[model samples]
Target: MSVYSMKTGLSSILKAYSPTEREKAKNIAINKVRFEMPKLKGILDAVEAVNEHNNFQPLNEFVAYLREAELSDNDFLRLMSDAHKLINDLSPKFTNLVEALISLPWTKRQPPALQAYAEFYIDIMVAHNKYVQFGIPKLISLWIPADGDAALWPNGSPIEALKTELEAVHRLLDRILTAIPMSFEIVLEAIESKFPYFKKATHVIAGYIHSVLWLIEYKPIFTEFVVQLVLQKLVLLDVNAPRSEIEETDYDDEELEENENAEIFEMDDCPKVGNIFAFLISLTTTDDDVQPMKHPIAHTIDICMEKMFNFLNTKNPNLLNASAEQKLQLNKFWKILLSAFDNVILPSHNTHHVQFLLFYYCSFKNTIAEAFLTSLWDKIKNPNISAVIRQAAVGYIASFLARAKFVHLPVLKYYLKELCNWAHQYIQSCDQYRQNGSLKANIVFFSLCQAVFYVIAFRSRDLTVDRKSLLFLQSLQLSAIVTCNFNPLRVCLPPVATAFAGVTRAYQLAYCHAILERNARRKLATVYANDVATPEETLDTFFPFDPYLLKLSEKRITLHYLQYQASEAEEASVVAGHRSPRRQRKRGDSEMLDDVDDFIVADKRQRNIELARSQEREAQFTYGLSPGFHM
Candidate 1:
């Protein structure tokens, strides 16, 4: 009988039987299809041919056959062999047919069928490698409507249908990702042929890989592979942003206003640059307030983190003034990566993974460094550079130097010494620029002071004497300059100068403590005897040097002296009085007496107010005026 006639006869036999016999009858019917399966085009085509009427009777019987079928290793291998043969006979509707096969209830439930479908999906994609390489990306683009791309999707293309199709393919892709003993090397072939990076389809491929990584269970081996793909795309986007130009009409505001909810990423920026960030955000995801129990792909996260840090460290005068949209997107990308670093990568460390991060950042030298120590210091010390860039560069380098491991401590010391030199030169330059009335040098001067303080703070106990001494002298120099030109420092850079004072005081105290500890260690005098002035000397330099300081110091002394005299007078008066009510009292006693005194004062003030008001009213009446003009 033909497939349709077999279904009709099975229905007739099922209706003739009672419910109790119906199951056995159904099994008999399903066994017939299972017997015909060996001669069918493939399991997929066999299912379609048996279920052509959409009554799903043949499909239901096929599911029963799969459920009862043996799924041992050898049985699964035989099924895959059949799939391999069927894959060779695929037509243009291969994706549609694969979708149909996996759609059956038994595909996932029956291990044999699921395995067969997974293998078949992989085989088909592999068989038409060129079609997949081109087709998968085109399908991903259908997710977004742009550049008349809506018409590119078939006229009746349903989004849910497309999503389901992608999911089935991605599930097989997941098996390949997990290395589930597939018959072919899907990932390797795609990597070699498609070469997803540096292409328009980069983000689409990344999203597909992400879907696979996301849907599959966490496989320890697959984590790094997935992260490598993510990092590759991030590097691609970073490299592309500067070179890509926006068309004049790309950001036409009127066009944007009409479609407020659509992806504005395509308006001016490179298509799917934001998708790089999207993949990153999705890959490193974890619950809030919970540490990722697993470390991210360590090398990958580190390299990406360092890249972001370096990008943010430099001014990139071009990027700084890039189109507003570009700048915003870049900033958003950096912020997301930084957040991922904090919440994902950093906590993934069991202990001191930041040691590698420090090594990576500080490992650069000379012309090879992306943001080298010398160039960053130059940027920080350059008066003409934008303050924002200078400040960021100084902060980034100083933070790393402060945290440098013991292996790189010598390099850190060298860089700190250079910054100290820059501080000295800035002090001298502040003079000529003082005449030019330029505040830039003073800003740099104040920023360097903060950076020095951070270094000291980070390495409070570990700071070498040379580093401490240089910072000490520099702090003194900053104090001296500020005191000599007090008005300018405050008028031009109050906030920075004030911060400089606090930082200088902190450094002074840290240095002083360090000196005392050293002396105690050596069993010598606690007083500092080196060229670097003690904290006391730094304080003394500020005091008794400025005339304003002299005046303030004298006034403070006089105020204390007068306070003493007043207290003495009050005591004497109290001693002379016999607790008379007329005797004056101290201001407060935190007792009933204070409350009574306050009430009395308030009552007397009220009486005086009434008396004044009555006198004013009488005067106005006697002057024969209506409280406005004299008679």
Candidate 2:
């Protein structure tokens, strides 16, 4: 056979089999009619029945049939599509149908069916605005997976079902928000009411966290509200999990290892025998055989923090690739985070880890770090603020300066100088007024002094890098602040006071050993004289940005943390040509003996003279401020 003949034969065969354009159109129209006829009939029947009887029983029956039927994914999708077409006929009066539709396990359906259900929900919400109050909460409830259902797969991956459901739910939310923007108020309220409690299973709380982050991604308008809400919840958890308890309890290595390996979602039914959650579960069981676990609240806190840290990192903008608008948005978010920190986390005491959210945030830029320091400083200096809040603000500032590696020396010195100056002015004011009140009366002054000492103890090496820096440090007059009548060294935490003394003595910046020895002698005398009824005054060792202890979230913290270097203090002492002679001296050495003798003599002379002056001025001087005088 010739090639041309074969080709001609094939072409003729193809031409005979192919349909005409008109026939193709006719077939499409015929299929459309066949598909829509039943759907139209169902929609008309539902609408007509509801309009005729002025009740939703027919629509309710239709929803119940859809729920009871084990239809294939495509059939279910077609029926939901038909339901969507009746949205305009539906109203707030269709409560029974709405409730039945809401009760369906739509999240368990396949992707196409899930999407069809979401569309129907959105269409109903948009067509009847009053239905939004019901629809939004129903969708939000799907964000938290029910018990035994979090792991959809037999293999038990965490939050797998929740992730799938949230994807569809958030898409439905985005569509509804676009159609009726006013529905967001309902959305926010539902989210708040549906947020999982801190004591709920870790995966359940984590599922809600995932949904929140998803909302922020799809709906940028919720960014501020979501950030505040998450932080507030985190603060709640943080306060409950006290750092003191974490420190006091000794966790076994095996238990910690078990907690690390245990799956988050396995807590409800099959917790590992000795893991943290199992210990937590034991509390509810009637059996008294199980011993208490160490710091189970800490474990919950770690999981919550890990999720929150990941959310923040996701929302963190990349400075290298971000545009101006992105940067502006980031700045706005930073401000919101700062506001939440001030309102929620700052006033909270004994919180172990919540403030790290702000710590992680300030690392985004140097300007943010500076701004945060400035805010803390403003709080510290503002007299109108409560004493307790001002004290906490100072602690935050000091801890931030001490532990944040990203804070440059110039910034540290700037705040250090500001703190010292504030303390100096406080001392001067006390002196000018002869306000020699007790330690309790002058607590804010002592707190400021302690913060100064703490910052210097942590950053001594950074502060003493050069002659110019040394001069700057000397100009702060820290010696005057320490030697003031308020006597911070005597009232502050012993280790802090000792560390500050060692650092100062090594640098020749101040001599505190004599004063410390005198205070120690006075304390002993008071104990011996049965004068111990006076409660000892001391500042709490609250380093807010201390080492991040969460095993999962520590990675986010360590990259920006400035670890304490014991060698820095020793090296600074060596370089400054000052070494402790007490280490080498015998107890009876004459030089040490003479130094002690001189301290005792000076203390006695000052006390005698002050006692005489007090006797003379008793009638004229008052313990408190005089009339018409203001501090």
Candidate 3:
């Protein structure tokens, strides 16, 4: 048959076919193209000449071109959109034509055509993906870092070698990130009713979700593809996430913040993001049973937490309103959530960002979550960190303690004791940090100290630490000496000053009491010789109010500055403010949070400075902030 006959035949079939019939016709046409693609391979050089000279306008259109009796792939997508996807117009028609040739079976006469077409298609996709949406393009750059080789990737693609062909491959992955998942929406509909096997491949749906999240700016754009991605990555418990997720997920973006020290505990059977993070937490401890997951899993979890915030942001999922069990599960994972407090979401790094994350978080429980808190005193005293991170961490801690005044997490007692112990050691180690003044080290120290403070102050009394309740006050005084007062951003303290400053002064009294108790234990052990370490017995505050926190609160100071008057308060009738503990929220969590957060601007330097003054003056005053605070 003539090439014109084939083209006319396909177009006529498409124009007349019904939806069901079209799909069938598309299959037949696709197979025909497969057969026909090779027959035209003999005329490749002629087409290349036309392409190189840029003189084929009248000769061939994008969908189909006939040069000297040779046929090319049809770029007419409307005619064959159902059958072939490579029918691109905006970028280059040559790409689609080459791709068609590449997919041809490698008969003796057409061996090189298939390979060349494959390489060309890859090159086109990479270029198209770049600078278009910039989502997938940006992502591929992260995954395919340049090695010395410039021709191909280690995984068999053309990326590792930094070749121009590989450059196009990268662009293609980027464009695919935006384009393919969109195609998945139609695919999902097909899967649901049109095809039986579609539901079985939810993993692919989930994979798309993970990408669409970054690409999508608004909620209305959520497609079946994006939803599936979330379902697979965050909610899917069956199969481990694909190996690509490891390349896609690890980042330090969620590095625990400076003042949050909850030692982010998690159950062993938790989800991948949490379970692996929990294991990483265990590596910081002395537990023999806490073996790490394989290194690859750890990398994936880290990536998910850091880079994938664009995917699964910790702020809140779009879907909510859990059953009692899910709520309980949420409560169960408060420790895991606590680890997020110190998390510095690069986007959410500012006070605005913190408010955004907290707006989603605060709706689940009154006051900030417990695991998210800090020791009240330590956050108050720290001068090393900017007041921005300092205030957010403190407010979260206060809210946490208010909630803690009720029945606690049960395991919190042990968490607090460990925090106290870690704080005690870490403050001492701050002096030894190689780059003590480096921002990373300071943030790490801030996070470490804050985590310790939460450990000591908010710990449950159930666990015994040396037969004495771990001294929360003593822990803060020590952690703060190095943290709040020792501004490495300014100058390092002298050795004697560092020693005398942190815990040495106030802790001497606590230490003296502890020493007396230890001596009594030693005397008894010497006499009896039965080996059992003393269990630390701690006491909890029965009263809802804490005078120590009341004195040190910046919230009170902010209120004093605002005179408790909102610049533009939400209307009492239109939007019942969250300030009314009794009022039911009228808006969505994010909206109500938006309204609440709308008033609290972080850049109000005058207000924060006044709050800082209040904290410095009355260390014993009650702040009435949120759930938890530094000791």
- In terms of TM-score, the best-performing candidate is 2
Question: Could you give candidate 2's per-residue lDDT for residues 1-631 as a string of tens digits?
Answer: 4567587764333333346876997667655543444334554586687799765555654654544545577767876786777778767666666666656777668978887887787777767777777878888887775666545422112445455656767777788888998988998999999998888765577667767877888788898898888878878877776654664563444654454355233433432443455445434553123232246666656766767777777657665788888888887888888888888888888666899888887887788889999999899888899989988898888888987878988898888888888887887887899986576677678878888877776676677677897788789887897787777877765445555665676567887766666666555565457645343455654667765556555666766777553324344233212222322221111221112111112223444344333323321221221110000
Please tell me which predicted candidate would have the highest lDDT against the true structure. Answer: 2
The clash numbers for all candidates, in the given order, read 0, 0, 67
- Put down candidate 3 lDDT per residue, 18-102, tens digits, no spaces: 7999899876765555435523442333345455676553223322322212323333212123222432432444543443433
Relative to the true structure, candidate 3 reaches a TM of: 0.26
Error of 1 at 612 (Å): 44
Give the TM-score ranking, best first.
2, 1, 3
Candidate 2 vs candidate 3, lDDT winner: 2
Q: Which wins on TM-score, candidate 1 or candidate 3?
A: 1
lDDT: worst 10-residue window of model 1:
539-548
TM-score (all chains, Cα) for each model: 0.34, 0.73, 0.26
Local accuracy by lDDT, each model = 0.38, 0.66, 0.33
The parts of candidate 1 lying over 4 Å away from their true place are 1-82, 100-119, 130-389, 404-412, 423-446, 456-631
Model 2: residues with Cα > 4 Å off, grouped in runs = 1-50, 53-75, 149-164, 247-295, 315-318, 525-532, 567-631
